[model samples]
Target chain A: MIGLRALATGDALPQVKPEVMRMYNMRFCPFAQRTRMVLLYKEIPHEVVNVNLRRKPKWLFERNPFGLVPVLEYNNEIVYESSICDDYLDELYVERPLYPKDPHRKAHCRVVMAKYDKMVPSFYKLIKPDENLRLQAKETISEEMKSLEIELGDGAFFGGPQPNMIDFHVYPWFERLTALKSIVEFDILQENNLHRLQLWQKRIEKLTCVKETMQPKEWHLEFFIGLANKNPQYDIGLPQSKV
Target chain B: MIGLRALATGDALPQVKPEVMRMYNMRFCPFAQRTRMVLLYKEIPHEVVNVNLRRKPKWLFERNPFGLVPVLEYNNEIVYESSICDDYLDELYVERPLYPKDPHRKAHCRVVMAKYDKMVPSFYKLIKPDENLRLQAKETISEEMKSLEIELGDGAFFGGPQPNMIDFHVYPWFERLTALKSIVEFDILQENNLHRLQLWQKRIEKLTCVKETMQPKEWHLEFFIGLANKNPQYDIGLPQSKV
Candidate 1:
């Protein structure tokens, strides 16, 4: 399991090892995880420098003006934003080629990713303890899932016959489904209606890259539930007692 | 001048010419205009089908699930979203490659575009008749323009030497700057503070594609001001009195 460490104001910046990629990440950040999944899938030679997002180091801000991650440091240049980082990685290391070769299909993949990207706010709403908001979020998720089912269309993955950018981009959200489920207790992926999505979830988990990178459901639930309850130490990456 | 014709229910769908590309656009939509500039830049032989956003034709929805322009129809298929459409065009027609060749530079171009895209809502705020919101929006635009001045960094365009995807993606918002200037009377591109941005603007206007496609300042002012005043005929693509 990945762990988080806080970097105070004067903390030493992580050394940039020659010829190795560095990823600045927060263990529980879905956005960071998105980039990490790509690196893991590509089996890129890299080092992970976990940052406690609450107390960001000046170096991180230097690397990324916005001070967000996952920032990829390679060849003496740093790039942030998960999608851009993923695009950079995919283009630089073309062993698997995440995007499709056909221009229209590539555009289609990007459009589908944009559609699901809009659902992130609704996903956050589900983690709220409020029942009304939970119901609303669930409804939004179901509608999005229905759209996903349609987008999946007879293909094993969004790109057909293999997982591509669309699948990699969206999987992080579903990785937290177990956490949301424990709290909201609504079955978003019912087999009767969402059998395709259900199967897709299982298939994704079987991948070694996903399995190795994913945090257990307990860690997600604990962190998110504490976050909802206004627990300040939620980001300490440990239980309240430990903090 | 390209004319504005609203395609409503029962209107004939534009013929899919055997070899030509078709663009579904609204004359005034900044997003739609992004695609037009690209088509004009490439001088790609294409047709324009203007959709009535107010009462969208069924055919528009049939082609695009969101019924949004600009939709590119070619080879018996359709794709929407300005960025996606522009990407498709750039890839399919490589004569004038809108994107950079190097991977890092391409990512950098995309990141710059994403940064400017966030400024649109603030741009709309300036169009509001309310003074408080207008001032707030002005501050946001100033900050963004300052950042733009930094990003321009001795380059004629966001991409060195010539305009690329970043320049085209961001120009639409600035296209309306003249209209906003007439209404809000705030000079964003001050000669002293924003000289680089101001110069960049003039450089863009000199491009034949931009010159051919841009609506005059007077037209943009009338439409956006009417829009701010809650005029019901805003979407009719006609002046208020005509409605």
Candidate 2:
């Protein structure tokens, strides 16, 4: 099911039992990856329905009028927005408890998450065709990375002994930084004084959930390259027969 | 405390007992208003320290590096971002729960909040100096108001008969629409087919929390006009003696 071609505008919605939870996802989307990571980390039994974002199916709009992915359908109810999805899952499951128990600590994680949200546009800018824009984005991202390094001070992860929701919330974009660098000839992590962040990335990458949910850098490269060329191959890694 | 002049750069930070929670705020900022509304709704005893966004106090950055308002300081721990502050307050003080008790219902509220967040840029555009941009923003906001009208179908409030956290989250922006309309000859709530939303605005405005937290429409008008003219009077409503 994971390897199936993305469902496009005219494609039929797949049948899933009402008991099972499903996620409307796009394989290359960082926002969707955050939800996918949480699902895996929490060991929630679910199905993935990859959508063609450029030519989204009509049913997708029914689930979320905004037509964005990381939309979770559970027990016939819909929830969208990556952070909201992750928070909902965490609250419902309550097994591992991704957020800190203390209200102040949880708020701190959220504050950092808010900062990361603001920095995302710069990450997207790195993939833009304009060299000057990409350079400016790199500068902004580098400055943000320094802030992240400070936030990560003396801890293996943002969650401190373990990877927390904030860690997963940010990891997808960090995971994509490599693909972005390959496309833009800039290495934000390596070239900047971000040693702590580099180590944090390595630590997060070693997690099982990260391993399971991640698409390879090469796949990201191919997808972004297609996006830059104005013809995104949403079914990039699917088998030829599946496509 | 609410009527104090906004403290600008180099101004001394006021002394508040560590036991008393404080919010770094701008009186006219709608984002700050959300936090202020939540605090009042929850009846969390807090002091407000208004800031001059035009020349923010140096110490404001110590609380929130972004130097934006609605930064909550409780027990010496800082939390910024308006939604984060509201959520932190809701979690810390559970009584009179603004959010629905059911997880799915809470998630639904969040979904609506996300839609509201996306529509805000267009609302801001209504105050822009350019007539064409204002016209375009009016069209976009009118379309979004219709969607809100549908969302409010059959319910007196988004929270269904009572305002919820999502109601407070979106109310500050809606409250400013009238002020926006006064500046630009466009009336999103009045001109569009949004009777439900128009009524929702009235219901929200009548709430005690909203009344206590909100500035008058005239204050919003004067503040916005100053903003449009590049000379924001953050301390407009304050007494001349205080200024």
Candidate 3:
């Protein structure tokens, strides 16, 4: 479903039959990947329409004024923001509930998600041009991993036995950690005493939902490399041999 | 219930009886006001313990790792972040449901909340040191008001007829607009064509919850002025005659 190339400026809107849910997405966006993982995990029937971020289509703005990916359109109504989109999906499709049922536990999940949101900038900081800043970010990330390792404790996932919304919310960044490590040349997980987080990552990597929604590490590397060079390849993986 | 002064460094933690909900708060924090409004609206029995933000209590960090206000402690479990705390409260005390029952409508409320969150920084930008940036931020805020006005369109509240979670989520910022206007020497609502939002603000101002939790505009002006001067009075309205 994800092989389709991203549509840039002036591209005509893709047609979608009424009643079919559609997600306006960017193929490699970690934020978009959160919703994608949720969609796959729930087996919700949906259509994916990738939009080029740099030269975004006009219609994409119509769907989400922020022009950010992971916007969900269903019954002619739209919901933007990746976490909100995932929550919306989980609420609508209750067969495989991703969030905890207890209010306290569910609130705990939200708290963990908020913490993950704060920690994300550190991962991005690792790719900064300044050496000192990159080193500082690496140190920050290692500290974060140690904390997370303690949080993981004896659980296989943040959700204890299986991955929950919190797991899906945080997993995309963990996946990108490798690509970031490739650029920074620092193995954060290995260098830190984060045995539980390391094991948790391994368990997450084996999930079918993760397998179906994740892009290759090389693809992430190429995308980030392009971004660092200031010429982001929004349509990185599409075949262009014929052209 | 809010008359108590803020506790600073070395201040002892207030004793909270078992099963009683406690909120770690700051008197003038708009973020904390959201949860305060909800607790009032739902008539939830909770204790308020204000913390001086600049010289925070060590126990405050123990309650919320970020050391941010609006942390809820119930049953020995803590939930930080205003939005999440409100959501948790709403879920637990469902008598007067703050969210819509329909999934799509609820998601729409969330989208609006996200937009409000994005718009909030511009309000703070009005107090920046750079004149050009402040002017730009004012313009941005005016444009944001126009968009919000359109979204409000003919509805009494964003939740339609009655205030909901979305209203509480956004109302705190609107409450502070007057103080911001005073500091910037600009009346955004009067200058801009945002009749609906203006009317909505008036309506929100009249709510019992709003009246109960809100500080006077003069207090907000004082707090914000103190903030701009790099010396915030976290205990602004407290009596100093005894000392």
> Which digits, one per residue and each the tens of the lDDT, describe model 3 over residues B1-243?
532778899988887665988898888988999999999999999888888898989999987878998999999789999889999999999988999988898999899888878878888888889999888888887887787787778999987898888889888878788766666787887888677888898899898999988788898988888998989988776679611
For all candidates in order, the CA lDDT equals 0.80, 0.86, 0.85
Please provide, for model 1 over A1-243, each residue's C-alpha lDDT reduced to its tens digit, 9 standing for 90 to 100. 222454545678866775778888877888988898889888887888777555678888888777788898887877788998999999989998899898878888887887688788999988766889877888888888898999988888876887788888989888898666766766788732898988888988888778877888888887786667765232444465533
Worst 10 residues of 2 chain A by lDDT: A178-187
Residues B176-228, candidate 2, lDDT per residue (tens digit)?
88766656776777777578888788888888899998887888898888887
**What tens digits encode model 1's per-residue C-alpha lDDT throughout B120-175?**
89988886668999889888888888888898899999877988887888888888
Worst 10 residues of 3 chain A by lDDT: A234-243
Q: What DockQ do the predictions score, one after another? A: 0.65, 0.86, 0.91
Candidate 1, A9: how far from true, in Å?
5.0
Please give the distance, in angstroms, between residue A68's alpha carbon in candidate 3 and its true position after superposition: 1.1
Worst lDDT window (10 residues) for model 1 chain B?
Answer: B232-241
> Alpha carbon lDDT of residue A102, candidate 2?
93
Please write out the lDDT profile of model 2 over residues A132-215, one tens digit for every residue. 998898888888888888989989998889888889988898889876666577678788768888899889999888998788
Name the lDDT value of residue A29 in candidate 1: 83
Candidate 2 backbone collisions, by pair: none
User: What is residue A52's positional error in candidate 2, in angstroms?
Assistant: 1.4
Q: Rank order by lDDT, top first? A: 2, 3, 1
Steric overlap count per candidate:
0, 0, 0
- Between which residue pairs do clashes occur in model 3? none
Candidate 2 A-chain TM-score: 0.96
